[model samples]
Target: MKDLLIRSATEADFNAMWDIFHTHVAEGETYAFEPGISREEGYDYWFAPRASTFVAVQTLAPHDRRGRERVLGMCKLQPNQVGRGAHVANASYMVSPYAQGVGIGHMLGEHSIGEARRLGYLAMQFNYVVSTNEVAIHLWKRLGFAIVGTLPKAYRHRRLGYVDAYVMYRLLDDPARWPLPEPAPEEDD
Candidate 1:
């Protein structure tokens, strides 16, 4: 219906971003974050200015009645750790229910991958994805993320009791196209 732009997030976006995050977290299927967590806490986590956050904003097209853009989704790319692990980017994405059934998530995810590579990340990893979120899981799999690890009964879902969680990883580079060295053989052998 309109043109969508993915742009860097700012403090002005905190309220809009929290609305989406809180709604999704309250659903108890996608993320491990506590739903009752306060707005301040959500702000601290999602609006960490030091990290990379992006918003999918819908702008009016020519002959449109709306004058301003509306935020449809938000995405954040954070470091998995401080030093050595910083080369890997970890991301979380949320799309407003009003924006569902559209391609907002896919657009945000694709934009995030390009941003990660441009930011010099060697790889991207989703540390804890609930197995029950089939939509997101399927999307990630289609996007080339491999299920590298799984934890049994890792998440304490409110109504579902316990559920499995996954660690998904995707190397940003194509190793086959740019080969690296094989490991040296052990002398004891």
Candidate 2:
């Protein structure tokens, strides 16, 4: 892995964070966010008071004269739901397009899992993963998530039309004691 540092996002990181988020939103393929979303709306969604936002910064080598670290990615972690469902965590990750395929997503995913566990969440769930996003689907599955359910034609892909979305989840605590219900067996004809 590169000399990457993952830390809680601060006020100084908002512009960089927004840049990465806006870029991805403009792509209109991964997240459900609308394109041309305003900075205020982006702030509210990514840096909400209740959510824990993080930034991944790549440190410059000591010999580099520029001596500046760059933000390569960002992620937000929050409750999947409110009240009785608060125990399960949810997260969204975005990597700078220039930094894609460099393992930053894996770092962010692993960091979020630990952070979620530290926050007392018993599990982590991604509610609307676009089924056509094979890279993410593979990554999440490699990171321990499972396709617990699929919402058919849930995502309106900008180019692929309506595509199925997956509900990916992983237990942070004891799996046998996880509170969610198991699927009923299919009846034989």
Candidate 3:
């Protein structure tokens, strides 16, 4: 297997990023975004308006692979909002279908948390996570994120009607002082 790397994105990465993003969004199972959103719009969403975006690439030795390395995954991070909410960070992630099951999403998620801490964010918040995305939900939960809130029947899922949406949060207090918060207890009806 080749070594994976995460780095800040540049203009050269937009096309590959679009391909990766479109592949996932077209499935309509995870992200709430429209399938037919234009490239220009996606560009603005990922790179232009966001604080930063990153691409994950697999590196090869001089004669290790058939061709040059290529991007396999990407992540976009930005402030949840301006003013009072500036201390919180938000991000979106996408991994190429070819790269799934290889832990690319996990790697990207971990890297984003580190980057968010380095950028001085008090906490990382995911505003609208579709509960049907069990892989992501499980991963985030294991990574110490709490499902702070659940909007019951908030998502209009294609197969499952009125699925819940979640607000997942992880507080990255300080690298030296990892303040692990206790998990919120599950409630029973």
Candidate 4:
């Protein structure tokens, strides 16, 4: 495990954040964005004015005086719908390929839940989770999200052809009663 720092993203972090976003979009296996999505489009989607975005960084070392760090992951939380349905939050997450499987995604998931609560959201919903993305599906389920609905052949995966997508939901306003797994210990590499 490595030392992970999760913080609200600043304007200065857009370049690195866009790199991760573009990488995932280009992969075309999970996210639904166009493979050749432009930086401006990526910025508009991930850094929406009303959305709260965050970044996860891995610090160089405890004793490093320069405070050097590497961006490993990022996420955005915002209203799933406007006006009437604003109580439910929507979110998207991306972990850099270099940091995949290192628990950075899990950290971002947990941090986003807390942030959503702090922002007064009653629940959180993921609109288009690619069904083939088993890792993310399992992670969201473990975090208390349920597959509320599925759209058959909703995603045109670059390699896998058409695939189903899931709409996952979780009531964050009352986690105490939710059947969520015990939170994992923070990673410390």
Best by lDDT: 2
- Candidate 4, 1-189: lDDT as tens digits: 567899888877888898888888888999988887888888888789999999998887768988877788999999999986887899999999998998889989999999998898889999999999999999999999999999999999999999999999999866565345568799999
Task: Flag regions of model 3 displaced more than 4 Å.
Answer: 60-67, 174-189
What lDDT score belongs to each candidate, Candidate 1 first?
Answer: 0.86, 0.91, 0.85, 0.90
Q: Which residue pairs clash in candidate 2?
A: none
> Poorest 10 consecutive residues of model 2 by lDDT?
175-184
- What's the TM-score of each model vs. the native? 0.86, 0.88, 0.85, 0.89
Whichever of 1 and 4 has more lDDT, that candidate is 4
Tell me how many residue pairs clash in candidate 4. Answer: 4
Clashing residue pairs in candidate 3 are none
Please write out the lDDT profile of model 3 over residues 96-151, one tens digit for every residue.
Answer: 99988888888999999999989878889999999999999998898789999998
Model 1: lDDT to the true structure: 0.86
**TM-score of the candidate numbered 2?**
0.88
Task: Find the number of clashing residue pairs for candidate 3.
Answer: 0
Q: Quick one: RMSD of model 4?
A: 10.7
| C-alpha RMSD values across all candidates | 4.6, 7.1, 8.5, 10.7
The reply for model 2, stretches above 4 Å from the true place, is 61-67, 175-189
